[model samples]
Target: MEWRGRRQSSNIEDRRAEGPVGGGFGGSGPGGGFRIPVGSGRGGGLSIGTIIFLVVIYFVFKAMGIDLLQVVSGGQPTPAGYERSAQESSPGEEDTKAFVATVLAETEDTWNGIFKANGETYREPRLVLFRNAIQSACGNASAASGPFYCPADQKVYLDMSFFDELSQRFKASGDFAQAYVVAHEVGHHVQNLLGILPKVNEQRQNMSEAQSNQMSVRTELQADCFAGIWGKYTQQKGLLEQGDLEEALNAATQIGDDTLQRRTQGYVVPESFNHGTSQQRSTWFKRGFDSGQLSACDTFNNPV
Candidate 1:
């Protein structure tokens, strides 16, 4: 992709130097004066006062419909609203940052135009660059969680190290592949803006785990389609080169739930799939690329 010299986004927050921010409820601190006492006894059991304090806190959060344990476990909770790299400041790292910003800017341009045509204003979401771990409005996350869009914060969190993992571990390499990752997260931002995310989340509340996973698959596939829409626009702008499309398709295939599971666990669990199969991912993306229309990207109400 001929992305250099193009506009770069000003919404990037480079938090790599800040290291991992405080996580958990109340910013990873000792929750004011509610510290859990360390016992010197045989099992290092909690003292009565500590246990009582924890119980009170648990009930308090529960009353507010928040699961304290899940939050403590780094689980992303549903938003109440209607909604990072290890390397130093080297030239290579700087180039990656620039590439990400350019890709983000491209997404902004594409979505802004698309939304304007539909008589809706698009609110650009910020992208946070971090290393190791960072605290988000949704919850705490590490580099291992990959890139994610938090609806509660309307931001995309990314660790550049994931690009290395994508190339080495997933065996999907290319500048366009990296762009696909950024575009996919931005797609989630689009979903949030259109109120699709909050609505799907509301519906997921009544769904079983398997059913919810199915919904998640559809949601992710739609985002892939949206990313493809961006690809279509980028191509029309004469930025894409030969084999660029294949690079992105290979990326979608490499990270598919079935492919990842088979590689990691030597088997595929159909019901546990949340991001769709490899074929479905590539197919949906191609559908969007071919049509370049939002109506063609609807994963729901159509057989995906």
Candidate 2:
């Protein structure tokens, strides 16, 4: 991917220095109710008990229509004892950060134009960078959960370390594959903007677990197709290098529910599959790439 020298997004929030495995919910400002400096005296670790307590607090605030996450993220001061010190990034990590920012900028440009063409406005989403763990409006999540977009906060949470895992563990390496990851999460943001997510959630409430999983597969496949739309845009701009598409396709295949399930449990259960199969993921992505039109990316009406 020819991402270098391109525009970098201003939506990145670097919380790497906050703490290792840092997460907390509920609090007005920095010290609203439970203000503790990460990486100071608490050994830079969050206990499971603390996380549960914060979750309880978070739901209480949510019931009252108060966003505790908003208050905590508003830049309140740290506690008296713990101080946040500076942390340095490696040269390679710095490049990765730049690359992610550039990809985010490209997605913003592409989605903005697409939304305007459809008589809608695109609201750009921020990307939050953290290490080990982070607290989101959805809930606290570890790096093992992978990257995700939070509808409540309209932010994408990521740990750059996932890239290493992608290559070393998932066998999906290459810059374009990394870009595909970003695009996929941004696709979720698009669905949220289009009110697709809430509708799907509502429908899922009355569905059986197996039926809900099927809906989830459809939703995920749609996002995959949306990512392919971005891939098409980049290809048209001559930004893709040789083997870039293959890298993305390989990524799509390797992360499929069937592939992961088979690898983990030595068997595949179609009814339990949430995301599409390996073949379906790559095929849907290719469908979107072959035709850059949004109509071609509809996974609901059409068969997978």
Candidate 3:
């Protein structure tokens, strides 16, 4: 994406290449203590995650009179030392930081335009660039947690090296692909502003595991569609070069929950899924791309 001249968002916090991993995320912010796991995070590198979504599910459902043990079978906790701070960046790391900053700026602009078009004000989401691990209002998380949005904090967390997972592991590479990931998280921020996230979470609390996963798939697919909205605006402003859309589409397919689950675990279980399948992801994104209208991206009202 051609993001050079855009306005960089002040909401971005440059925590990318600093501090060791594994510090306490609890009480790290003002007026905290809200326990919720916004999304299922991928562990970056070797650092394990201390607070997984299952724990969050357990605690969140405890409040709703649901036993998490019934739904969350078992998964090993992320190893210790996973929470340590990240090492200092090398000399060339500045370029990567700038790229991420530029991406944030683009998302800010695109979303701002979108909000204005709908006659509503935009509430920018903060982007936290951390090292191995960082503390959030939702919980303490490691880079292994990959990128996630904490609705409680209204912030987006990312460890840029996930680009590696995107490129080397998932085989989805290119600058635009990386930018797609950022846009997707910002899309969640959009959902939060639209009051879609809280309601979905509430509904999920009373749902069976299969039902909750279905809701999550809808949520994730909508975010993908939102990301497509951002892409449409950017492309209109002359950001598209040949293959840019393919890069983004590849990214959407690469991160599909079903695809990730099949690779991370042994097989795919539709009912246990959080993010949608690759086909659903690709389809929703294309829906948003084809029709740049935000309303067109409603995965909840219309089945995906």
Candidate 4:
């Protein structure tokens, strides 16, 4: 949106590889490094060696009952591929990285203002731009896993290639739609700051599988609404172009639980849906954008 010449957020960590991607071998040359597998494709599934390594690590931590999110999200003792760092993104991806940082900075500014007005402090979440695969507080995930926010370490994981897929494969083309995806993940971070995640997790632990899925749907929808809040802010700032709002709406509908399930599995299971229906997602987002108030995004209390 009104992002031209705006100060980009320094909190972002660009982790996109400069070399090979189908192998997750960039930024870290070959030879026994920790790697999260992408699903069902090259550079996706865990090799036997990786499996053994993770098993050993898992047991070591299990003995101490230590949470691994810290290590995963912290990216220290250093995640294998952060060597060159974000500053070293290839010339090709440099623009994309900058744009992502700008988006993050805008979100920070908007949220910071909201928090300040409410007499609260807002801690900005870091955005990790990675490709192929990444290690996250949530676990080792791949670009295929899509963008996600890990509350354990308070960071967002993104793969720039997903934007290509968003426009090309999903046919949801528009800069604003791409922005919506990142904003949605950021919304999850907001939920974490508000204690919604821990509460939801606690409730999920005691709920039936079906009920848990419904809870997840609520969580996803709320994130969508939060994304819409950002969209409203961008609109006010004169950022949206012709059809930009519809592009985001179209993207929201394209990635709904029902749609993804049908595309990936050739079937849809309502009770198994963790994200809401396409209509539900678009509606919640529209509600948030129309209200332009964070208080309106209470999917937990409102019927989906």
Give the range of the ten consecutive residues with the poorest summed lDDT in model 4: 30-39
Tell me model 3's lDDT, rounded to 2 decimals. Answer: 0.74
Q: Which lDDT tens digits does candidate 1 get at residues 90-150?
A: 7888999999999999999999999999999999999999876677887776666678888
lDDT of each: 0.80, 0.79, 0.74, 0.75
lDDT of 4 by residue, 95-179 (tens): 7777788888888987887779889899999988876777766677666666778887888888888888887867778778888
What value does the lDDT take at residue 251 in candidate 1? Answer: 89
After superposition, candidate 2 runs with Cα above 4 Å error: 21-86
lDDT of 2: 0.79
- Model 1, position 237, has a per-residue lDDT of 99
TM-score of each: 0.79, 0.79, 0.77, 0.78
Worst 10 residues of 2 by lDDT: 31-40
Sorted by lDDT (best first), the order is: 1, 2, 4, 3
Q: Which stretches of candidate 3 lie over 4 Å from their true place?
A: 21-88
What's the number of clashes in each of the models?
A: 2, 1, 14, 2
Global local distance difference test of model 4: 0.75
- Candidate 4 — which pairs collide? 37-44, 38-44
